[model samples]
Target chain A: MIERNGLQSGSQDPAPEGALLPVVQVGRPADVPRGRADAARNRARVLDAAQALFAERGVQAVTMDDVARAAGVGKGTLYRGFGDRAGLAMALLDDRARAFQAAVLDGPAPLGPGAPADDRLVAFVLAYFRFQADHLELVLESEAGRGPGARLAKGSYRFWRQHVAWLLQEAGAPHAGTRAEVLLGALAADQVRHWLVVVGRPADAVAAELAAVARSLLR
Target chain B: MIERNGLQSGSQDPAPEGALLPVVQVGRPADVPRGRADAARNRARVLDAAQALFAERGVQAVTMDDVARAAGVGKGTLYRGFGDRAGLAMALLDDRARAFQAAVLDGPAPLGPGAPADDRLVAFVLAYFRFQADHLELVLESEAGRGPGARLAKGSYRFWRQHVAWLLQEAGAPHAGTRAEVLLGALAADQVRHWLVVVGRPADAVAAELAAVARSLLR
Candidate 1:
């Protein structure tokens, strides 16, 4: 239980809120889904081959047959492993996302916690933007068929929102829940891509401004 | 032009900025897409009939045949005009959306520009939520096939974003552009519906909290 600070009250940490620790589901034994070890190895080999092909020739030019040939696997194997081109793209996205989430959960300060609340908040926003900056194509590809405004429901998004909300509460911010939501939404990849790429703003400036805005919103 | 006083700064309205007038695409002679007047009337009649049917029986239960029968229009006319059942639903959504936008542009005080910028901002957030609350089904209907994160690109969203940005600039808020984007994103139909309906918070309280969050973000 996050101690209920009056939407306006203050609190020194209470001892009972163990489940609501600074570290979240991040450090838990990750439920990394897998198949038979040999089968999983074959899957990884196929994905690596597909990733290299995508990087070299671009997604549009690479076909399933090309992936099979590069992985040295049969077409039947590729077909059985991945339902289709889109499915393959999503699996690659999921593969990268796990690592990203892990880093945010347990790796380092600012992004991984143990920093001041404001600093942690700032780091999270910039980290999200940088991730999008580095992998715009993959991020966009993974989001291809989502319903309008389904953003709040994405698995990673729910975690980010909860993390931000908890941080804001710890900092004694009023309306922390809504503020965290707004902050996350503002840092959405689509908007970040637009501001960073299309609008030609320096990435650092946007991150700094976002940090300032986040501070302004906090009490 | 909108006066840019700090949220804590002072201003009795400065000289007018014509480009920044209260009226937007709202008061412009609405180009109601018209066919022959009689054709338009029949379209309206069919839509009204469809609306009643949808309200009486859920969307899934009501079919095109039923709509055509209720409207006294031939099945071919329904098919030609709407393309299919989902098309009819979208057309209905578009119809309501156009009205909503028009109201914001030209409607009475608080919602329109007659009120102070802060008041108008609050009204706009509440009004948006109410629109979603009243027509969740229609709004969701229109969003069915949208690509992920496409919410920011909707035609109405662009207009609302512009309107909110303009209001924020007028109110002397820092980072009006980014703040408005975040505010709008947080109030996205999906999040609003989840908090208000799924979470069982009273509509008014959520609206009030949203208004407070918007104000806090300003300056």
Candidate 2:
């Protein structure tokens, strides 16, 4: 079932051309070779254990040995699967990211296709923040050394940009592409985590602010 | 005179705020501390040499020895005055950065203070891109290790944000703060360089698009 992440959503509308997350990109989909049931199962088990342990102790404090032990897998398999902690973090992000793209692409409204463009825009912001909150530590660590503007080149980033641009165009907004990029800047992972965690602002306040920004821009 | 950056041909009104290039921000405005004319002269000469060398060879390729030789200063003076190559890069950036801030802060109509808010906003985008173009290599080098987001916390960044927010409010734009931040995102050093160099979009085209976005938003 998880393998279906590689498959498109039921949307008649196609995903962007050539947008499968690059193998080098964080959270590239699980392109596990078919018929590797055992490999897939082991992979999932490791991820589940890794997520629990990392969330319990935080990403920095958790060791690979601990994850392998908890997953009941050989250390060799852990290394072979995820390569290192950064790789593991990216893999976990990949799983959640894939699920998110699917849900938004086809799951349900107002996040899916059925809601008004304005509502979908707000819903996307709220949903994206929650995702950022859940993976705060992972994202901050994983993105180290990638320059700030560098994230713009990511497949996931492009996807969200396209989504926002489409909605802006739907509402007859001028300069939708540039506006979408600016709007999307508000949701940068580094900035979001800083506001939520460092500044200790509740997620609700930030969401309210973003929704307000969207309303102002889209109005 | 520096004041000329502010006064336009038709404007009877002078520019706003005490906005001259501060001596401290770039070179501490001749902190000669009395009876130190020789030291000031050497400092000025070194900076002139550094500016020309950096512009010619790019930041990375130039070395401390090259600067010292070019300026006819002893190596000790160069190190004592600017610390190292990185220090020199920053000092050079500071010089230009201060000039830019001054010009926009109080120079002439449009960018300075006398123009309408919307014109100021458009003029700002155009002027900022030109500034970025002038110091692209210096900025990229000077701002390294400061995460792209980290630049947001700098004093210079705060000043720009405040300026933009003030203008947005003057025009009765809602969410002025958030909108200002999003607007400023397009001017980030990393992203600006990427857009200008990587995407190969002409600065004028990008500026026009941004002007259109601002127009739509403010309307």
Candidate 3:
């Protein structure tokens, strides 16, 4: 299970040491226990509302005020929870990332543990491509100003890279680690945007092509 | 035969309409012809000096004043020729890019016209990886703050993408255009930096892995 690390103060925090490690807070103010449950509920509601609004109207058109109003929460609560629109986007991405991680960890075959490594690799590429295509706007917003390689520093990226490398290793691929980096580099958000948006390739077509490339690597 | 488009004014020019088209300048002041040749010589001298200084010391440590002094050009000439250090970096990269392009077009087999599609593709990837490894600093500096997808708009990127796509097509690969984008995406500057610098992979090893991936696509 993925641990919610709480809201990052800003999405641009430099790569923290052991960024993927789950740290449980040991102590807090006496009143904080009651507040934590409410805060979690509020955060979920805000993220749900933001996701719907972002889907309905593009990300740039939706404002923090709009998100707060739609979530039926105070603007103060929304701001306190997310800091800004980019922070909200990052949180939404984090939320989706955790869910995807869960699916890969414990869900079904192909993407989970049951399928052969090559099948799982193909499935992962297809699924991740869909995830990227679905959240392109949010990913771009969250990663803006952070350089291209900044994602490599994120826990989610480390997780993806490790998973891909493991799959390659399982398939007895030579230079698995290096090849995994190159494969994932091909899936970077900007590259996805270029393929799907700028080049106007169909999502299915792009995903299929990428999946083929993934399968090719297994050889 | 690459046409010198003269100084780009700045390297961050937005994707120009007919960006790769050759434009011929028609008219100038009576004295401008003499000034043009002098300007070309001065530009070459400054670039050579900057390249040497950058090679001697790292790109960051070499100042514009050092380049001007080393090249025997004044500070005004240095700034006038290259705008700033990033501009200078871009110009140097452009110079190298042109040379590479020429080699690919007219040089020997494997990288040139005589080789089979798969062989050419592998050769191109290997040669490009080496080019990227050697000039990582220059590429990063030239691309700073321009965003990750910014390179896609560059004429050089367009050229590379077209060449890869053509080679893929020659090999009868499906979805050649999309796959080429994916392949070139793997060779992105930041990705190369992450593999070579951050992850500490040997450049030759990375290049070999990438070449294998490229060759796999031909099947």
Highest DockQ: give the candidate number. Answer: 3
lDDT of 2 by residue, B150-196 (tens): 55544455678788888888887776776777677766666678668
What C-alpha lDDT, on a 0 to 100 scale, does residue B107 get in candidate 1?
A: 85
lDDT of model 3 at position A69: 95
List-wise, what DockQ does each model earn? 0.36, 0.32, 0.45
Tell me the spans in candidate 3 whose CA falls farther than 4 Å from its real position. Answer: A1-88, A144-148, B1-88, B143-148
Best by TM-score: 3
Model 3 C-alpha lDDT per residue in residues A1-219, reported as the tens digit of each score:
124434442222322422422222222222324345677777778878888998899887898889999999999888777655555777777656656777888879989999999889999999988888888998766655344466676555677788899999998877788778778877878888888888897889888888888877777
Candidate 1 lDDT by residue in tens digits, A1-37: 4332311100111112111122233233333333466
Q: Per-residue lDDT for A23 in model 3?
A: 28
Q: Alpha-carbon error at A204 in model 1, in Å?
A: 3.7
Q: Write the per-residue lDDT of candidate 2 for residues A18-51, one digit (tens) a residue.
A: 2334322334343435436676688879989998
C-alpha RMSD values across all candidates: 11.6, 8.5, 7.0
- Model 3: lDDT of residue A129: 85
Q: Using alpha carbons, what is the TM-score of model 3?
A: 0.73
Please tell me what DockQ candidate 3 reaches.
0.45
Docking class of 1: acceptable
- Cα lDDT for residue B204, candidate 3: 83
